[model samples]
Target: EAGVAQSPRYKIIEKRQSVAFWCNPISGHATLYWYQQILGQGPKLLIQFQNNGVVDDSQLPKDRFSAERLKGVDSTLKIQPAKLEDSAVYLCASSPRDSANYGYTFGSGTRLTVV
Candidate 1:
């Protein structure tokens, strides 16, 4: 089975600029997730989706970030007026269902550089 796919492997933007990242989950997967990883820290869960419905977004910075999983298959994450603190790797992952044992498959990630 194919893993998650993300585009533009890298992105460089000046502070306050907007940026978007795309992801396509594995076939038949019903759950999707987005995570932000700062250079020296572990990945933080930004948002999660179960068949296009939001499951969790407690850690997401709502004022500057947003995401959507349309039709339960593809998803996109966007940042408006991105801040220097937003420079990090945005990762996409998917799972057939919520199970810690099964785990999720992650994409290569979109590395954002906010200068």
Candidate 2:
């Protein structure tokens, strides 16, 4: 079973630039979720997709953040007009929980730093 995959491992951008991150969830997993974690706080769910259909995205910051899970597999999360407060770790995780339960298969995240 391969673990989740995230890209760049790190990123730095100006306060209003746009950036995107990619993810590949584990094999055979039907549920995928993207989360933003601040320096000290716990991981916060941004969006969740199940087989290309969204299950939950209430916490997603639509003003600047958007994501997609086309083909019901891989995914990408984007942030446009990034802000200084957007610096955080973007994590991608998957579980057998379908859409009701959640767990952490924590991967090396894309650490975005806004300047």
Candidate 3:
């Protein structure tokens, strides 16, 4: 199966700068997820979407982070005024609506470093 696609595999930004990452899910996937992975820790779900609507975003830092899945195919995640603590890998994943049976396909992720 084809994997999800993410751009700018690495990024380095000064503190308080802004950055954005883009993702293209596998064809036919209806569910999408964005995750943040800090060093030595498991990935944390930042946002989730089913089709074009948001399913959950409780973990997303609204004050500094935002995401959208327009048309339910492509997605983007952005962080503004980034902090050192936000330096982590931003991962994008996708799955079918009935994903529990098939599992999710993840992208290589964008590594952001806040100086």
Candidate 4:
């Protein structure tokens, strides 16, 4: 099975700088998700999208972070004025609309470092 694709496997930036990450989900997937995984901690759901519409974004820091799924195929996440606590691996995952049986497909993730 094909996997999700993420760009810039790693990144480094000074605090308060801006950065962006991209993701391409598996073909035919209707649900896409973005997560933040801090070192030694479990992944936290940042946002979720069903096709081109947002399904959830309660966890996203709207003041500093934003994301969009264009045409329901590709997605991008951006963070402006990043903070030290923002240093984490930004993971992209995808699944079918009713994917309760099949688990999610995850990308290698973009590791961000805010010093």
Candidate 5:
């Protein structure tokens, strides 16, 4: 089975700098998600996309963060003027559907550090 793909395995930026992460979901998958994982905490869903539309983004900090799925296949997440508290692993995942029974395939994730 094909798995999710992510790029720029790691990044380092100073406070107030900007950064971006990319993701490519498994072929034929219909659901994609972006998560923020802080050390010692469970991953938090930052955004969810079903096809090319946004499904959920209530947790995303719109003021400085944004994401988009182009043609429902590839996606990108960006953070401008990043803060120290934003240092964490940004994970990308995909699933066939948003059901309790379906499992997601996750990428290795991009580790972002805001110094």
Candidate 6:
């Protein structure tokens, strides 16, 4: 089975610009997640989706960030009108539903650098 895949793996954008990140989870996985990891900090859960329906998105910054899992397979994360502090790594993860310790697999991530 193919592991999670993300594009660019690195991004540099000016503040106030818009940027998006992509993710492809492992095949047959039923749960997908998007996380934002700041430097020196553990990953924070931005959103969790069970298939295409949202399970939780409480931590997501709805103002400048948005995400989607249209087909419940591949996913995307976007940051609009980026900020200098928005520079961070965006990781995509997924796991099987049957296990509580689903053992999420993460993409290398899109490292956004805003200046």
The regions of model 1 sitting more than 4 angstroms off are none
For candidate 1, which ten residues in a row score worst on lDDT? 95-104
Error of 2 at 15 (Å): 0.9
> Which stretches of candidate 2 lie above 4 Å from their native place?
99-102
lDDT tens per residue, model 1, 1-91: 7889998799999999999999999999999999999999999999999999999999999999999998999999999989999999999
Q: Model-by-model lDDT, in order?
A: 0.95, 0.90, 0.94, 0.95, 0.95, 0.89
Task: State the lDDT of candidate 4 residue by residue for 1-115, as single tens digits.
Answer: 6799999999999999999999999999999999999999999999999999998999999999999999999999999989999999999999987565787899999999999
Per-candidate TM equals 0.97, 0.93, 0.96, 0.96, 0.97, 0.95
Cα displacement (angstroms), candidate 5, residue 45, comes to: 0.4
Instruction: Give the per-residue Cα lDDT of candidate 6 at 5.
Output: 94
Provide the lDDT at 80 for model 2: 96
What's the CA error at residue 56 for candidate 2, in Å? 0.6
By TM-score, how accurate is candidate 3? 0.96
Q: Candidate 2 on 78-108: residue-level lDDT in tens? A: 9998999999999998876674546557678
Error of 2 at 14 (Å): 0.4
Stronger candidate by TM-score (5 vs 6): 5
